[model samples]
Target: MTILDKYILKRYLITFAVMIMLFVPIGIMANLAEQIGKMIDNEAPVNEILIYYGNFTIYIGSLLFPIFLFLSIIFFTSKLASNTEIVAILSSGVSFARFLRPYLIGASIIAVLMFLMAMFIVPKASAGFNEFKYKYLKRGREDRVTTNIFTQLNETDFIYVSSFNPARKSGNNFTFERFNKDNQLDFKISANMIRWIEKDSTYRLTSYQKRKLRGNREIMETKRRLDTVFNFKIDDLTPVSYVAETKDLFELNQFIEDQKKKGASNINAYKLVKYKRWALPVSAFILTIIAVAVSSIKRRGGMGVNLAFGIFVAFIFIFFDKVFGTLAEQAGFSPLLAVIIPNVFFGVLALYLLQNAKR
Candidate 1:
């Protein structure tokens, strides 16, 4: 790399490092202030609190990675433009595309780090962060689905319940069904109530009735109560909402496959987390290009103008991401499409801005 490339890349990395250092503590302090009372009320231990904040750094930082990259790039590049450093480098016959090489290199480095964090590091932090939040901060709040649940256990097995009580480890109007390989109903079990007997490790069903279909006849049986064992756990009836975010890349892939097998109702939500991890690295590149194009030009209003525009764009990008993510989770929108739309839009904007900046 030439001296110019070295100079630009150094500033790119240094400014980003400084930005993270400066802001993360402020974020931690603000969060601590807001949640300190909750922690005290819950009697949270000091060591756990310390570890939670450590995880908080990674969890929150990963979410805001693109925004920080955008703002830092704008801040440093605007300084270069304002001081005529960019002009000096460009005037010496460096092509506009060539001038962008160091910034791209810096972005590539950060992108790889972001990829690692998103796939592996952030998940661990997310697990810790969420565990602490739900355990202490959100005490007594509902953590799992409790009403009108249905799940396909396998190709031939299915289960449903009208309502569940986690504390009681039971459900009302529980029904279990098994089908033949040919998709014929083999047998079905219905119960007025089903409860997990923890001491005995068995499921107790009250007002139980079973009907079995034979080749030429149907067999029926009824009982006041029965004890049985099944392939799934009580918790499996409704997974905690943040389960996807807490899993690493490989684990998440396996989980999605399992959820798909079960015909999970919220499969799109898990799929979104998987797609976003892949998309995040791509976003680093898009945001970097947009930042350079927006800020690496001298303007009458100076750095403030560049920063204001950067903040606006950052908010818009986040808004689109959150909106599309919600649509995928709540509606039946394609998770892959939700991930792609915002990145594709911003990628086009980056190209347009780069062209204008070149001229």
Candidate 2:
């Protein structure tokens, strides 16, 4: 690379580092302020508190990666424009496309780093961060499951529960049904109360009754208490809120497939997370282009004007992402499409800005 390339790339990376160093501590302090009461009330250890904040840093940083990157690019590029560095570089026989090369290279570096963090580091950190929050701050929150739960466990098996308490690993009004290949009801079990025994990996059913169908006859059995194994686990019945955020890419894909097999109601939420891992990286490129095109020209109000415009665009991008992601999770919109739409929209904006800046 030329001296110009190295100069621009160095500035790009340095500004991004400065942005993270500046914003992340502020984010941590804000989060700590909000949750400090809970931590003290729960009598959390010093070491555990430190660890929770450490994980929180990663979790929050990943969430705000795009905004940090956008602001960093705008900050540096606007300064360059204000100082006439961009004009000088362009006037020195450098084509606009050529001028963008080093910025794209720097963006590619950040994108890869962010992608790796999202795929590996962030998930582990998110798990710890959320675990600490729910354990200490939101006590008894994880124990609550949706009432009147019904789900298909497999092609031939189904389960129902009137109420479930995940903390106690117990539920009431449980029913299990099995169907034959000919679509006939083979058997069914109903229990007044059911509890999972972790040590034995079995379910204990109280006031149990079973009925089996054969040809034109039915057999019935009753028991006060019964212990048996079934295809479903406690997690399959009561998924935690941050379950998707805790899984890395491979684990997340496998989880989605497993949920699909079980006909999980929250499968779309999991699928959204999977799609976003990829979308975030692609958005790095789009945001970078937009930041450059919007800030590379000198303006009357200098860097502030450019920075304000960059922030506006950043907020719009985030708004689109969140709105579409919610639609995907709650309204059955295509997860992939929901994740990609914002990127495509902003990508077109970037191209338009770049074309205008070229002229």
Q: Could you say which candidate leads in TM-score? A: 1
RMSD, candidate 1, Å: 1.7
Q: In model 2, where do residues sit more than 4 Å from their true spots? A: 143-145, 152-156, 180-184, 197-207, 223-231
RMSD (CA, Å), candidate 2 to true, equals: 2.2
The 0-to-1 C-alpha lDDT of every candidate, in the order given, reads: 0.94, 0.89
lDDT tens per residue, model 1, 253-344: 99999988887778899999999999999999999999999998999999999999999999999999999999999899999999999999
Query: All predictions: root-mean-square deviation over Cα?
Result: 1.7, 2.2
Worst 10 residues of 1 by lDDT: 139-148
Evaluated at residue 103, the lDDT of candidate 2 is: 90
Colliding pairs, model 2: none
Q: Model 1's lDDT to the true fold?
A: 0.94
lDDT of 2 at 245: 85
Local error of candidate 2 at residue 199 (angstroms): 8.2
